[model samples]
Target: MDKAARKAILRELREQERARWWATLGLTSAQLDALHEHILANLIDCCSGELELSEQWANQVGVDWSRLEQALMELGGYCDCEVEANVCPD
Candidate 1:
């Protein structure tokens, strides 16, 4: 394949992977972005050593906390700072 075709294929694969990641967290891309921003801002002080900020963001945005938290933990995001660092779009 030409370079353009190869690039297109790679782009499509990335989109698919991003979609799956968000789906696993029961969130859309926008929701995840919002959550990330929230955590980033709140984490200026420090990580609460738990998912406190993430849960607050979920409640504020009407996201399913149980599903989101489970998915985050599975992805190695056990706290606000961890969520910002580990759980994010590609």
Candidate 2:
């Protein structure tokens, strides 16, 4: 994907994650900021093939790459492999 396309996808992904966090726990703006940072770092790693995923972080937001990838793919994006998960264990 081009830079613009990649940026847009990341933006969408971040917004989706933000919405989930907001609805689930009503996180503060600062918390949202941190969450965005975490998401971006993980996203970069995944994209670059490093694949350094943090299950703790994933659990915090209630979704993983696999789940996010599914959501993105359903929205017409391409996913090359499995990601973490979207749901956390109860």
Candidate 3:
């Protein structure tokens, strides 16, 4: 695809992400704070090579892990092994 097309696609994706972030903002303060802590703990565990602990944290949070992971990524938290590379492989 051409540069303009690529740019348009990226912009659309970013807009969708922004919408998702806004949805998270609609959550109650308590819920939001809990989620932030859960995400933070998960990220820390993952970075420390504690995959099992990360999974446990997700389970304790009682949220869909996939959705929580996506939210964490959008919020600028890194968990993947490639975090130092600044690249998160899906």
| Poorly placed runs, candidate 2 (over 4 Å) | 26-90
User: Top lDDT: which candidate number?
Assistant: 1
Question: What lDDT score belongs to each candidate, Candidate 1 first?
Answer: 0.85, 0.48, 0.53
- For model 1, residues 1-90, the per-residue Cα lDDT tens digits are 999999999999999988888878988888888988988877756676799999999999888899889999988888877788844332
Ranking by TM-score: 1, 3, 2
Model 1 worst lDDT run, 10 consecutive residues = 81-90
Q: What are the per-residue Cα lDDT tens digits for candidate 3 across 34-61? A: 6446545455423553234334555775
Residues 1-90 of candidate 2: C-alpha lDDT, one tens digit per residue = 799999999999999977865554344556545544664555643443322333335467675546544443453333221322322211
Top-TM-score structure, candidate number = 1
Off by over 4 Å in 1: 86-90
Query: Which one wins by lDDT: 2 or 3?
Result: 3
Report how far residue 48 has shifted in candidate 1, in Å. 2.3
Better of 1 and 3 by lDDT: 1
Distance from true position, residue 70, model 2, in Å?
26
Comparing 2 and 3 on TM-score, the stronger one: 3
Model 2: which residue pairs collide? 64-85, 66-83, 66-84
Error of 3 at 29 (Å): 2.7
**Deviating ranges (above 4 Å) for candidate 3:** 1-27, 36-55, 80-90
